[model samples]
Target chain A: MEQSGDRVTLGLDEVFAIAKSVLVAAGLPERQAEPVARVITEGQRDECHSHGLFRLPGCVQTINHPRFNRAAVPVVENTTPAVTKVDAGFGYSLPALEAAMPLFVEKARTVGISVLAINNCFHFSALWPEIEMLTAKGLVAIAMTPSHSWVAPAGGSRGALGTNPIAFGWPRAGQDPYVFDFATSAIARGDISLHKMAGKPLQPGWAIDADGNPTTDAAAALDGAMLTFGGHKGSALSTMIELLAGPLIADMTSLESMDFDDGVKAAPAHGEILIAFDPAILGGGVRDNQASSERLFSAIVDQGARLPSVRRYEARARSLAHGVQIPRHLYDQVMSLPRAG
Target chain B: MEQSGDRVTLGLDEVFAIAKSVLVAAGLPERQAEPVARVITEGQRDECHSHGLFRLPGCVQTINHPRFNRAAVPVVENTTPAVTKVDAGFGYSLPALEAAMPLFVEKARTVGISVLAINNCFHFSALWPEIEMLTAKGLVAIAMTPSHSWVAPAGGSRGALGTNPIAFGWPRAGQDPYVFDFATSAIARGDISLHKMAGKPLQPGWAIDADGNPTTDAAAALDGAMLTFGGHKGSALSTMIELLAGPLIADMTSLESMDFDDGVKAAPAHGEILIAFDPAILGGGVRDNQASSERLFSAIVDQGARLPSVRRYEARARSLAHGVQIPRHLYDQVMSLPRAG
Candidate 1:
């Protein structure tokens, strides 16, 4: 890593090494640490700083916590013809997903559609990585997970929902998969924290004050509740995630996850739901559907509209050749994380 | 029916009878008219006037169109273990949905999840009735369909997408199923028409002018493009629907559906995708998830946030007892429609 001014540039290999080392030193076994590190590295490569090495300290803290099982082994079960369940054993979600994904893909191909339920996992990453995995295998994928309760339901005052995210991925014939992952919250909780740290005001509809009044004060909004995007529509999607990824998987809801935090405030421990569809079976053939899908894409871009993830793919290309730049302070923090043994 | 001032009130029975009579008179066979009439009656019962008897004339027009096949019979095929395919044979979507739903539900129970694809259909009504059907069968349901291209992608100028409604339904224990059906567009096209008719200016974010500039003029927005709800997130969802329900099912995209209209402006001819999940299989038992789900509901309601579809359910109860009221002019329009021999 080369430090210049307040930033450092590191090659992708270095990023992976640093992430894996930090996770291993923190307490996660090599088996569980590898996939998590790869996901982190990919985040940096794609310029998603929020989920990159910046999150290593938080991951370490969660791993070192008493409730988190750093050495946990995920068990995958074929519960039904169209359902695959993974008991994550209180471990990080990435490794559990890695464990189940192969079988999940098989089931989807066998049945035309399938659901993957990952229970009792601590999740602190973007859902796009998981979605991309399925798309890479020529499948259509939708994934969602609930976070801690920090968002308010539309028309409600207090926080009762998470910044639940929904991600989708569609495979292309010979290009990067079409993908999008977004929080149901008006804005990410981390963005609000950044605004608070910078002493900046938030947008009007982004949040409400403690007493349920709309507020632009970042600190007040953080202390109060964030609003869902598009009002009730976003709220409904968030609630759906809470139900499908939560109790539908026999895991915790956002409220239950918050209660489980008990002031420790580690990454939210819950479950995730993902569905994959085999295009060959559902759409008859991916090659045939490709033409129709491309038309839609051209229609969007021809009118100067950008498809989602174009920026990420562009960054990925640049990073593959020239590495990624990270803030010096964030790099220093990752290096200074306390080792367990 | 009793006319009071400009409005007329009719019992639910009368609503169904009128709907069925209008369809049969327009040359739709009795078997096809029955399910379509029941759906229209339900729409009026729930006070969704846009899809109620007001739509009867559109159905008649579509049925009478040279391209439409009023007597087309839907054929259901169990394409895969997890997919049920229905060829609507250029007929209305409701009958195709009705024909396939039983097999779809059985597949969901036999496996854990199932997808129903209804193709080559003219879809004009709201999707809630179909979602409610699966919910009534004790399955969690999601349905989506592309309509006429009238909405624009988030950053684009011209119309490249449809209102593209998505609906979700979750079965509850002994209560009405939790259901929500909403268009991905900022507002429904019919609402814009209503606003234009009433000489009311639209809300700012609802639409853009023909030149792609933001506009509050209802007529200009209608001639131009409507915006998606929540900006890019909704746009992504709308795009997903286009891919899933359109090409994925070997049916028409919104633009193609509009092209088939060729300025005739009948209801969009497209395909629909519906997925059903058996809670008993996926979540172990719906009874267990019911408790967790109830708590989430309580949290939302306890915080003064209204649950989605509460108003619809309330109206449904009232309509069951006292029936529904319609504008007298609309009633007369339906009654005086030109009928075939």
Candidate 2:
């Protein structure tokens, strides 16, 4: 272990082991604990600290619910030639999505495209893993999910939208997939919290004061609301995600999500949409796609612009090599938890 | 006709009829001219003058090509139980999309979801019509397509991305569907051209100087490149659209489109994607969806934020009742064309 300032560096294996033990201790059944732990571990591996172990304690709170279905299994309610609906039993999103992608791949290869609609899931993890997984399997995947409303509309004063995020993945044959995941909010709520903690002034357009006037004060913005990523366009994206994940999938809207809550906070139980495409049918087959994709990435990187997936993909390699640095307080809190029975 | 300063207002039917005559006179087949004309007239009705008759002469230049196929028809292939592909035969997008939406809607209603991948078409119209069509049939639809690269990616100077656009539509049983269409660029490139012509200063974040520094001088910005909406997040969306509508669909990318020219210039040859969702399978069926969708729209409208589709819908109604205005010079040019023999 290496300690520097307020940060502690630990090996990938150690992080995974700790996460798994903590999840089990948090009362997740072993079968469920491993996959969820792996999702958190991968976030840490990818250096997405926001979605990594920092989010695990909240996951535990939802899991600790008396009504939480420990042995819940995803149910396939309807299967057509091209689309499938998976009822995720109101559990975490990763496992359900993991179970659904193979079916989408098979359908897409045969028909050139497929859609897997997943409902009633707590989607707390980073979106890259599912998309990256499909891209590795030689497919193009697009995913969208909603969260509880925490953003105001472009001209409005109230929080009426989730940070609602969208993700996309494109395959490059023998290389890492081109992928990106982003929240439609100008700034994330967690980021605002961090800015407040550090007493840092925020950039313009990041948030608004209680009166709906734009503000540079982090604490004031925290008490008000986050702005959409690109003004009205970001607000539109968030609205679209909410509809696709809510009424379109027969799931709860952010406004409606509060009605179902019993005070145990976790990722909102939202629906999600994932569409996959077969490379052979669309991209002139694997070889041609690989060539074009590589050229595209080269153009981006040569211009000194980072491809969305490259940074995380490279971070994964570094984590396995030199390990990840975690804030000592965050690490200490997890380590202090009792071991599983 | 009512005169309004430099423009004249004509009935919507008259606008459509004149447009149809002009397109036919420009060498489009009668079979194809009406749809294309209707698309243009709708733009005028919506007060979207940029895409209205102002764009028709360019459409004519392309349609008048010696190699232009007046009988061009979309070919559907690679159909599976779940997905279908449409090759647009290098024609305009409106007719091809008009042919494909029915099949997608039927497939989605039966299978829970379906995707229509369209290639080899010139897409220059608003995306709402197609999405509105599917949503009217009680389906959720999302559409994406790419265009000429005129926007710079984040952290880079040269233009490497299109103002790639995305459109989404959600059903509302007794009311108009909620729909939206937007360019990925911070401001439409055409808007910049108009600003230049009007001697107007550009808005901040709208564009950059050739050296990539943000600038408010419209002329300098025009000499440079447009900025992507929301910075890095917008770049990611543009990249995703490129992959989906280009390599993933065996189609020409913006860069590649620029390479293929037979003298005549118009909308670039590109591909598009549209995915439709069956509300019944996910949203607890029809009545539940209608109620929830209406509530969602109510919340948006009640908060004083405009719903994307409502304005367009009302515009269509007003155009039908009170007519639309056309600039005299543009109207004169179209009227001067000889009717098709």
Candidate 3:
């Protein structure tokens, strides 16, 4: 972070330690607290501001809730040769997804592909970390998670889908995997909130106003529904994700999950889908798979393009040297939080 | 059939017969000719004019090539409990995909999910028909295929990605499945061609001209590369597709496939990825899956929006009665072709 004015940078270790302390104080298990911290750490490390330290309070809101089932542990509800369904037991997605990844990787290596469906978790972090974890192990991974409704279907007036993020990762030879994660919306709600704070005008088609008219006023658009990217095509992909991560996993849609939330400021029960394929087995073998990926990426990169993981990796390296900058006000809030005994 | 000004209407059967005759006269086998005919018939029936008779000539250009393997059959190279790879033997994708769908559906039912990688074929049909077959059988499907390079990456000057269409299907009990298919580019090339033909100005950011500057002039944009919808996010999705449908199946990317085409007006050996998930098992069962889907559709439809397949089904009903209307010159061309034995 450039240290000109209100910015204060802290070492990643300091940030992770503080986040872990906050999670424990919020009544999460020590084992569970660590992954959440890493999510926040990597978010800050990789410049994912909306998901990092700034969002800790929201995470705490759910973890500190009396009915949040803090002691629940995820379990594999069913298993096939290549598919597994995990009941998140109304916990957090990170621990559940983390536990499921190894199982998925093992199964994928055996059968060439594997799928893990995790339901009942409140996922509050960036998804690239999860997909990247698998891709780093030389596998191709696709993961999707649903959220409470925030986006309207194309040509529809109501907010009927989540910001519904989907991520994909491909393994590259001796280099970082090509990983990209994005919500299927024209813009994320957080970005809209920032624009509203800055009193900035929004772009056309990014959102619609109260009467369902397209608007460039950030505040009005925020009051309404976010639009899907690519018009009908993005809406179609989002709906597919709505089913795949929700009912297909015996969980619920964003609307259903919201109903179960009962208006509480807490984590709502939700669902996620993770599919991993061992490219070595799915393609020829390790060498052959690597060549195909490297061939594609080298061509793209030569033309001065940046794949998803590449940019994140660059930010990651920068932060490794300069540390993460937390806003002074947010840092004060972290300092004020009760520490774990 | 109704005779209207500037149009010639024929029964659906008549349209299919003509398409089949044309393909067979180009020396395609009867079995192979039938699927291509049905594709054109459905295109006309559903008013998908671009993919209908307008595309038939392109299909014929490939089919009539001296080196085209019209008699080749699709062969499954390997089958795991949940995955299968089919080599199309340098033939057409319609028959190869047709031959593999049963295997995929059966495997998905057994293991809850299955994937069929169909490669070495030239796929030229709209994807819905294939996914519709699965949804008709109560399966949810996702299929993606790569094409000749036509889309440029975000912030890049040259076209390095295909229009790369993807399709998704969800089963709806007692109704046509919810299916939608779309290309990842900001606009399809055919639409660009139409714009160029009509001398229309395009909406800004639809494409970029030489030197990578954004352009709205339809003719110049047609001479340039189409942009990915919503910028980098869509570009990422398109790139993910390029690898999955291209290199993963031991097939070539758009550029590679073009190189092997050797300037012939023939179909390139392309690849596709097809995944089938039996929601009946993936969900609680068929009823539970139906309830969730119906819940989603009901809410969206009440808002006066129709999912993709519903409109197609309506057109299908109309065409069944009114027949498909073939344009005058196109009908004349079809009439001029020699009839098959």
Candidate 4:
């Protein structure tokens, strides 16, 4: 691994090996470590930094906790042609989500739609990758997940909600799929951490201190609650996700017992709900749908329209063409970590 | 009708009478006037000021136009257990949406989900009422509609997208259905008009002038485009709606030529798409689903959780108990319109 600033450049193989080794060092079984490692590394490859290598440390710590039943497998207690429920058995979200994807895709093919509600799963990495996978198969996919407390209610002071994230993906014709992944929070926790690391103040109105006073100090904001993205609207979206992902899926009333540090304890287990729609089931099949999408998008762009994800796609392509440029410090931090044999 | 200041206090019956009579006088057959009147009146009752009585004069003018095809009716061209497509035959959206709802509900009851896409319709009124009707039947509903030029692309200037709105409704146990309805614009067109009426400057960053420079002047903002809420994320959402409601429903793309002033000549043959889902089809049946949702919302609230639509619901209740509080000036404007019969 070569150290840049806060980023490290490693061959994909090497990155996976190191991640697996780290998980093993943290007491995960060798058998389970590889899959977890692969999932995380793939996230980095896809440029989902928040859920990529940056989350390895957290995952390792959670896996090492005796409360987390890493050896347990997901159990499907109920299923239908279009819906399924997976009990994660206190295992990480990666395995459960991985197990559900194929089932979801299969069901969608038959019924034109499918839903998978995963209960008792750990933090799944960036949801967009999973959405991307579904969209690549010409299906429209929406994934929602809730977190431990990080967001405040509309006008209240205490952090009572998570920065619940929702993602949607749509397949396009002759262009990159339109993928939208966003947190309901004004800014991501990773961005807050970064600002803190850089000794920079947060923008005003992004967060509130414990006393409910808005503040721009990154450290204080960290100790407080992140504001919702679009005020009450974003907060409402987060609340909706919590109801759908946490309570509805896990059969819990609220996330009161979900402590940020209890990555091991499964009380008030985090959940995820995914809904998939197959375009072929509609009036036209996938090809026809694609053509329609193409025509509309072309007309808009021809009429001086700009698509939201176009810039990100362009940036990603450029980064891929010239090796991902990582900051020296971040690179050094990753490189300095002990490597597995 | 009594004019109070610039406001008017017309009983619900009188308001309906005026609207129905105007549409009839404008050449719509008496039979079609009732549904159109019901839709507009419901908007006022629901506290959606902009889409309600405020739109009466404009709609009347459209109805009077010779090209409007006032007597056209929608035709259902496709049907499945859970999907339907209706060709509106170049009519108004109100009748088409009203006609599609019961069908959508019936299909969802059979298959646990249904999607109705209507093409060649005009701009529909407030979406929440339609969602409210669906949720009352113990189903989740999502509605999307595409409108004329109002919103700009993420980074570029010029209006290329509509203030496409997406509304979602979740049926809760014993609670008023959770409804989220908002335009994707940072500031809705109604807000801009209100600002102009009040002779107030809009908040900076909410809109851009025709040349694409950010401005707070209401007139400039009116000539310019509204920024998408939450920047790129909101823009992505708006684009998704356009795809789903516009071309997916086989309606004209916003980039196509159309006249905005004359709904008959400039109308883009817009449409509405609705998706209804039954909770019983998932792992748990409807009862369990409702119970789970109840528990989740309670837990979040126990921890000071505040949801996005909670206040709106409260406001609605108050409005119901007392009556909708319309601004005096707006009331006067409505009452001052030339009466028919």
User: Best DockQ goes to which candidate?
Assistant: 1
Question: How would you encode candidate 2's per-residue C-alpha lDDT over B1-341 as one tens digit per residue?
Answer: 77777888899888788788877887777767877888888888887777787877777777865545667887876465556677778778777777776676777887777777787787677777778778778788888887776778888776777788899988776777778899999998889988899999998988988888888998998778888998899998888877777777677666566455433456777778888888786565322656665766677777788877566778778888889877888777876767664
Model 2: pairs clashing at backbone N, Cα or C within 3 Å: A82-B82, A249-B282, A250-B282, A250-B283, A282-B250
Native A-B contact fraction in model 4: 0.23
Model 4 alpha-carbon miss at residue B91, Å: 1.9
List the candidate 2 regions with Cα displacement exceeding 4 Å.
A1-7, A262-264, A284-287, B1-5, B65-67, B262-264, B284-287
List, residue by residue over A1-341, the lDDT tens digit for candidate 3: 23446777888998899889999998899878888899999998988888788878888898866556688787865577878877767778888877776777888888777788887787787888888888788788899977877788889887888888999988777777788899999988888988999999888889988788898898898778889887887888889898998888777787777677787846556888888876655565222545655766766777787777676788889999889887888888877888786
Better of 1 and 3 by lDDT: 1
- Tens digits of lDDT, candidate 4, A1-341: 56655655666676677788777776667656776887776666666666567666677667766567878687774365656777777677667777777877887777666678877666657777778788889888889887767777767666767778888888876668878888888888779989999999999878988787898998888888888887766666677776666544543323443653454543234678887877676535212456656765664576466765565577457545544444566455665565566
lDDT of 3 by residue, B1-341 (tens): 55678799889888888888888888889888888888888888988887787776788888866556888888875557888877787789888887877778888888777888887787788888888888888788889888877688887877888888889988777777788998889988878888888888888878988667889887788667888886898899999988887777667777666666777836566888888887656665323656765787777787776687676788788888888777788877767777776
Going through the candidates in order, their DockQ values are: 0.62, 0.60, 0.50, 0.30
- Please give the ranking of all candidate structures by DockQ, highest first, separated by commas: 1, 2, 3, 4
| Alpha-carbon shift of residue A113 in model 3 (angstroms) | 2.1
Interface RMSD of 1: 2.4
Estimate, for each residue in A1-341, the C-alpha lDDT of model 2 and write its tens digit: 78999999988787788888888888767767787888888999999988787877777777766556666787774476667678778777667776776777788787777778887777677778878878888888888887776688888876778788889988776677788899899977888989999999999988888887889999999778788998788888888888887777777677666445555555677778788888786555322656665666776788788888777888988998899999999988877776674
lDDT minimum window of 10 residues, candidate 2 chain A: A282-291
Off by over 4 Å in 4: A1-8, A24-35, A76-78, A248-269, A283-341, B1-10, B65-67, B257-268, B283-341
Model 3, C-alpha of A172: deviation from truth (Å): 0.7
